[model samples]
Target: MSVRQTPLTCHGHTRPVVHLAFSGITDKGYYVMSACKDGKPMLRYGDTGDWIGTFEGHKGAVWGVALNYDGTRAATGAADFSAKIWDARSGHEEHAFQHNHIVKSVAFNPQGNLLVTGSNEKIIRIFDLQRPDAEPAKMMGHESNLRHCEFYTENIIVSCSDDKTIRLWDVTSAQEIRKLEFPNIVSDIEVSTQNRLLTLTHGNTVAFWNLDNLSLIKEFEVPTQIHSASLKPDKSIFVCGGEDFKLYKYDFDTGIELEAFKGHFGPVHCVRFSPDAELYASGSEDGTLRLWQTTVGKNYGLWKCVQAPSDLDKPGDAEG
Candidate 1:
């Protein structure tokens, strides 16, 4: 018989959790940041789901959140028409980049020296952290509201929109590099620098692309309308959640469904794998975030095993 895997549920946000991001492993362990409709963004311990602090200056719903590579800083995009950077350790607002319209997405480059934002105005802007007061470089082309944006490299950016397209831009030249058209609005996108893969979900399909060449590698048709999906660090498997209020896991190579379970009481908006890939976290319209293990029955982080008396007497039990 298979053991039922239970997830670690985190609750605090009074409104729907819209986005979730995990920082790379740092000296203090990695961290998880969440954006919510309550106008507050939160940072928490990644492994244990323990609340760390909340950044509280946004006057409107926070639509996007991101943590820098080392987890020292955080950035948030909000309905207040601004993107603010905060000290991850101190929880104090460092700087705010004002926008003409609501900002929908924010991301920090690998070096943490720059920030990229996408707004309702269908424009993308890059802010130089070293010179916060300097005018940001702007890139424009998207025909509709921007859904998500992120740094593809130090000099390249990728953005998706409600216009039913994904676009790439060159930061130095402020020019559009390439654009890919889709039949439906792209809901979520994940750029994996380590795996050299780009994962995208739109409608009921999930597509993977070669990060270097932007060529289609493969695509999978999911049973439900997925809002978000994430590839494991090794690219062996993936997980997604959607309007069905169920989390689904699949084998990456063959596109075979591995598991499907319902946990959230409402639609899930975002899902992301931890930097270590031991677990994946999901945020929902139910106003909660949940962390699920990638491998069931394995002792990892806050998830532990309770051995029975018979198992405790096994030959390898002591070593374990």
Candidate 2:
């Protein structure tokens, strides 16, 4: 028997939701951010999807948004050819970094001191948050529009593009360290917290790679083209959504489909797991963000500390 668990819907954006990010868990709980074509990026409670506030300064459709480790700051890239940093607590703009073409992705280093922005110009730029007026460190190589990028280490980053490849680079040296080619255009990429495993979607396939040595670990073929996917921090489970308009969860080690459910009316564009590994959020073309618990009908956050009974408490006790 199963308990019918429903996702909490977050609404407000008038356009399609493109990207989503979750802040590391904190004393106040984790926060979620969403970027949409409506030109507004919003903050919400990670588990509940309750609206907190909106960061409202972008002049064009916002394509990507990320929250710093502690959720104190946020960075967003937009179709306006610029990226902006905001004080997450107050929803106030802090700095605006300009680009030559539409900005597609934005990410913050683990330390929260550096920001990386990828754009339609096929360039990746790293900006120092401490010195907003200074020139950003730039790197080049992607032949097509950028899709996503994330810091693999303090000095290294992995980025995917529509050119059907992924490249690893040294931010300090501004040189490519490794490149992995794919058969089709890569749509999205997600890395584990330890940066050891990465999962990506291209065409109708979802593949995993070893981030440490740059090797393909495994691949899973899905029925439809996936737009986004995320692996649980422990690498035990993964979830994906896309053209099928369904959310599919799988066991990473065995490649077994655990759950497949219909949710959004439109295709899902992005999905991310929370830091605590308890829940995940999905953004879709339906213009809303939905939150799902890792274990249906289970409240891990509240009952995680409760202890189970001893053997003596069982009906057939050993001592008896």
Candidate 3:
């Protein structure tokens, strides 16, 4: 029998955590950024869940958060009708781009030169970070409010909405390239640039797609209604949580459930794998973030291994 590992629970949020993002591994290690309904966004050391600093200024609930590749910058979208960019190291707001309605999601392009945002106005906007004063390029199509958006590539962007469709757009042309309709509203999407796969969760289905061609790779029916799902960096397994207030892990290829444990007292809203795939983090309506090990009993970060008393030799038991 295997011993269940205790997850590291991170506290501080006063309300539900709506979104979470992990930065790429940096020289100082990676970082985790979180958005909460309390109108506060926070940054923490990714490995240890140590609170770093909170980005202040939003007057309404923060809905989305994103960290740049090198962990030097962060972006957030909020119900305050704005998306703001922050200097990750200083926790200072650099730019606040105002929107007509609530901004639901934000993403930084690979080069960190551009930012894209989705809003309740049913539009997607691309802002050039280099020229903060310039007007942003807009893309429109969805009849309902936007849920999430991200850059599929340097020249392409992908967005999902309450309209039950995911659309891909050419950034340069500002035109829709393709549309994927789902039977239910897509709640979450994970784009793995490293693995070239797109993971989407909707209704009771978790689907994987080929990022290059937008082809259907595989789809699995989950037992519970999941809001978010993230694939391991190596593509071996995935972890997800949702309405049932339980975290689940499953084999990626076999679609076999590996683990299902209840940790959060409330529903989980977001989950993502660490850059190293050492562990994954989940944000919940309980107003906390929990980190679980990919491989239990393995010593990584703050998770140290301990030997049982019977396994340890007596003081004088060993020969010199």
Candidate 4:
């Protein structure tokens, strides 16, 4: 038997959703944040598609959104040429850091005291949340606009750019440690809890690398160009969505497409699994987000219900 899950659509944004991020699970619940061209970032329940609150302030489209470990704080990067921090509980703006160009990506360190942002200026800046007025540590090397970045460790960060490369940097010295060049322009990158780096490139392919050594691990070619992909915490499966307007699930080890389903009306821009491994959220060009379960409709518990066959087709009975 096959289980086909239905997705719950979340509506509110008036423009295309460019990014989606899930906060680390807590006793309360996990939160999902979305960045959109509408200039507003929204917070929601990670498991369900229910609305929580919207962080409104950016005058231009927000390209990036990230939540801290506890989901109490959030950071957003926008075309307004700035990155702003927010108190997620109150939905209030905390601090706004100015940039030389449009901010494209934003992330927070594990400690939650540092915020890293990559921008169209081809530079990555790390800001001390405790000192908003101080100058941020800058690392520059990308030949094109920066797209995505995340903390690989306490003292290191990984970044991907449109220049067809991913670079690793040391936080303290702001120096590039290593770089991995890809044949196609990298569009998005994600770091799993198991310390695996997954990247989606413009060539309709998905690649994985060892986060510690930045060495090539595996790559899979998809039928369509995937804008974003995320690996399951257990490394059993991965889900991706893109130009096909459908979500595709693949076996992580074999790279075989396990299942595919239509959930959005437009191209999906980003997809991320919940920290609890219960569900995943997808943001699309249709200006909405959808939530899907990790196991479709079947429960993975010890016991499962079985159905008995009817007598109608039990024997080779002749047709009337």
Candidate 5:
């Protein structure tokens, strides 16, 4: 037997992995970056699951991780009231950021020169990576815990929080430019490579927002609370997962649930799309990372791997 699905195991930490990201390809498609409650981040080759390097600097749990568009650098947010920039390949510290509260999320701007971070303190701060010691411009509008955010352009960034609102920030002014209120608290936000916005909130609803005007485009109701989402490099499609344990894909224009993947034994905590958008990776409270292939129709035999799927076939490996 071919064993059904391919699998790869990464087991260095004792705690659960909360977030994972693909560097868009600087490591020759071999490295996958991950963060955990243990207050550290690990980089390993996706093909062999060989631990390449480690990043250690946070006093509390590292809650979020993000890579620049170029894949040369990475950013991490921790409960220690700060977010830091690191050299993706060397694991060297680039900059340290101080925020109002425990940092919950961090994202690099679409241009890759600026960084945005959100926190329980209810504010988002914008930092210019070139100036490591300069004060960051603050964005204040969210009233509750701001969990995560994404940048739409060099000047605009959107953030969501428990306050039930999404606010847009202007990098130059480092202030709130606009706001959109949701029915419930937002747990995560993703901006598509094409500039469309998707946010997963307190309920099962995933609302698509238009960044140009900050208007609602569409929404699909899920069966459980959503935790995270990933936008394909194009604006046409995206995927999200939640405590409901269901993974969903939908059309950006119609809000139709096109297909789904269900097999994880625990709540899904995070989801991400690869640089090319052909593949995605997810981690959960259940202690596993699931990888899937997405297209217009159902995901067939392309791949479906947990903990690094070593079974079906490797990305560049030929079929047996």
Candidate 6:
């Protein structure tokens, strides 16, 4: 077993990083992107945690950041009420998509041709990348904000909201397929397929559902309000982070705590697994990003990283 190590640190944003995503890369992976309430987005090298550059465009805080599978483009949602497309490497603005209200979440399809944006306006808009000027295929059902969305397949998209439900959407018809009810407002959601769903409860719980029957397979108990959760390809081992500023990993078969990661002094907002699932990353209110090594049944410690700085002063950027 390998012990987790803090090999590097970078610092820049003044606000806590609310979202983080890594491109689908295995060997010599290139970039990891982070979004903050400070109105800045950052891209860093995965292996070394080196600062690449800042994506300076949004006027208000950035709510979400998503990179395509190949990692060529990045889509950002902001409190500015818009979603913008940016060059993943150059940090150049490719397009500015206007929405009626603050954009809360954004996701890219598996093929990277479709971009989806959900907003407080109670609307989900799907845009075709090949045709930038085309009208978006819209899906409207939720009466409240669509908080987070996960594209399970080309035809299916799962979204969770403040309305306390998880909705499944059909991309071809741009209509809602089903609405799965939950006990609390959803904080985050991930899917391995249309049949499997992993939802982080608003409070301190994580639940896995088999959408085929809308039945709960496992209700993994957690200690803190989960800010985010990430799943493995096999859907056996997973992790969640919360206000306690700790990352907890569990084995799905037993629902027992496998390991706990401690580093962020502030609330952890986002967590993600690398494409190969050998590594995972977290973003936090500490204005920092952390990476961890994971194993199936064993405990791997924390490999937390905090980045370098920007010329502009922001909230979470302070070296904590």
Best by lDDT: 1
As a whole number from 0 to 100, the lDDT of residue 194 in candidate 6 is 33
Q: TM-score: which is higher, 3 or 5?
A: 3
Candidate 1 lands at a TM-score of 0.95
Q: Per model, state how many residue pairs clash.
A: 0, 0, 0, 0, 10, 13
TM-score of each: 0.95, 0.92, 0.95, 0.91, 0.82, 0.87
lDDT per model vs. reference = 0.91, 0.87, 0.90, 0.85, 0.71, 0.79
lDDT of 6 at 196: 64
Any idea how many clashes model 6 has?
13
lDDT of candidate 3 over 250-311, digit per residue (tens): 99999999999898999999999999999899999999988888887687887755344342
CA RMSD per model (angstroms)? 4.8, 7.9, 5.7, 7.5, 4.9, 5.9
Stretches of candidate 4 exceeding 4 Å from the true structure? 196-200, 298-320
Error of model 2, residue 288, in angstroms: 0.8
The residue-by-residue lDDT of candidate 5 on 24-53, one tens digit each, is 555376456777888887776553445777
- The local distance difference test score of model 5 is 0.71
Error of 3 at 10 (Å): 0.5
Candidate 1 residue pairs in backbone clash: none
Candidate structures ordered by lDDT, highest first: 1, 3, 2, 4, 6, 5
* lDDT of candidate 1 over 2-93, digit per residue (tens): 45556778888899999999999988899999899999998999987888898989999999999998999999999999999999999999
Estimate the lDDT of model 1. Answer: 0.91
The superposed Cα distance between candidate 3 and the true structure at residue 139, in angstroms, equals 0.5
- CA deviation > 4 Å runs, candidate 6: 1-9, 26-30, 194-196, 295-320
Scanning candidate 5 in windows of ten residues, the lowest lDDT window is 311-320
**lDDT of candidate 5 at residue 308, scale 0 to 100:** 35
Model 1 is weakest, by summed lDDT over 10 consecutive residues, at: 311-320
